[model samples]
Target: MQMNDQRDINAPRAEVWAALLSADVLKECVPGAQEVTGSPEEGFEATVVQKVGPVKATFKGQVSLTDMVEGESLTLSGEGKGGAAGFAKGEAKVRLEDIPDGTRLIYDVEAKVGGKLAQLGSRLIDGFAKKMADQFFENFQSVVEGPADEGSEVAEAEGTDEASKKKGWFGRLKG
Candidate 1:
């Protein structure tokens, strides 16, 4: 599956970058994120509960940032295993640009699932992935454009946090 997203943040490029990479912000933004272990400056380990149709599983995974070009762009890759449910791997390239209003955050993502999970079909997986991505960006926008608090403050530089909303990864995944 593939996806793309863009958000206009009211903060500066530096601030947007910081908030986007913060561990606290990511933990809050990412759907079903249980714990974020490691640094957003680099990456981290995560456990997330995901579901599709009648299938449900908790996934243990690692996410990392690679092919970085300072404030220009970066490549992030990760994989998750849901025990009996199946496994999935994905990569996304994010780019930052200065816009008339603020910083424009853009991303292109691609993902693949295997095992019994793959049998669920592509439309399901694709829809699920898009939903997850939307959730993350939505939270990011709220934080970056709203206020600057301890959690909402920028991470390495430009950043923010997704409120106290505890996300449940429950829904039929579209592929």
Candidate 2:
């Protein structure tokens, strides 16, 4: 499947770019992500748990960033193995544009699945993929913009300390 989307984030382009480079921020943004480790330059190792239709699996994956152009754009590619649940591979090309108030984040994504996941039908898989992408970007926006900009209780409840809460998700990550 292929998808394209954009989000207007209320932060400087540099800050958004930095957040994109941080594995900690990516872990917080990715839906169902249990763990995400490593740096953008070295690539990341991730474990995520999710249920699609009737299949529930823990996916072990490696994610790498390529075609990097500093704060402007990059490509993210990844593949995961889920034992019997199936395997998934995909890539996203992400671009950041400077806006008057903040930055415009745009992405084009393509994904494929095999084994049981592929057997679940394209409609189901497509919807799931779209939802995952949306959730990731939404969380990323909240992290970069901070709770002051978006005011999400869910963000607050996600185990941040009082100091970190006041600092904003991205700011806390910088420490």
Candidate 3:
């Protein structure tokens, strides 16, 4: 499947570019991402658990950044193995532009599946891929823009632990 989208983020292009290269930020934005580690120069290794239609699987993958043009644009490519469930691979071409509001983040993505995942039909796979991409960008925007609600500050003032803060973050994302 293939898709393209764009979002205007309320932050500087440099900040957005830095966040794109941060594993911690990527881990938080990705749905079901349990862990993400590595540097931009080498690559990143990730573990993600996901459900598509009737199949659920844990995917182990490696993502690499290439053709980076400083704070402007870059290409991201990754592949994951899900054992019996199937394998998934994709590439995303991302570009950043300076906008009066902040920064405009644009992306074009193409993905493919094999094994059992390929049997799920293009419609289902396409829908799932679109949802995932949307969710990731939404999450990234939220993170870059800071807390979405005043309750987060209240929680922090109330001395909420790190775990509680994370839980609240996820709750807000879902809501």
Worst window of 10 by summed lDDT in candidate 1: 166-175
Better-scoring candidate (lDDT), 1 or 2: 2
Tens digits of lDDT, candidate 3, 1-175? 9999999987788878988998988999989999999999999999999999999999999999999999999999999999999999999999999999889999999999988989999999999999999999999998876665567677778787642543323334444
Quick one: how many clashes does candidate 1 have? 22
Q: Which stretches of candidate 3 lie over 4 Å from their true place?
A: 149-175
Each model's lDDT comes to 0.77, 0.90, 0.89
In order of lDDT, best first, we have 2, 3, 1
lDDT, residue 98, model 2: 95
lDDT for each residue of candidate 2 in 91-110, tens digit (9 for 90 to 100)? 99999999999899999999
Question: Which of the numbered candidates is closest to the native, going by highest TM-score?
Answer: 2
The local lDDT score (0 to 100) that residue 82 gets in candidate 1 is 91
Q: Give the Cα-based TM-score of candidate 1 against the true structure.
A: 0.79
Lowest summed lDDT over 10 consecutive residues: which window, candidate 2?
159-168
| Clash pairs for candidate 2 | none
Q: How accurate locally is residue 117 in candidate 3, as Cα lDDT from 0 to 100? A: 88
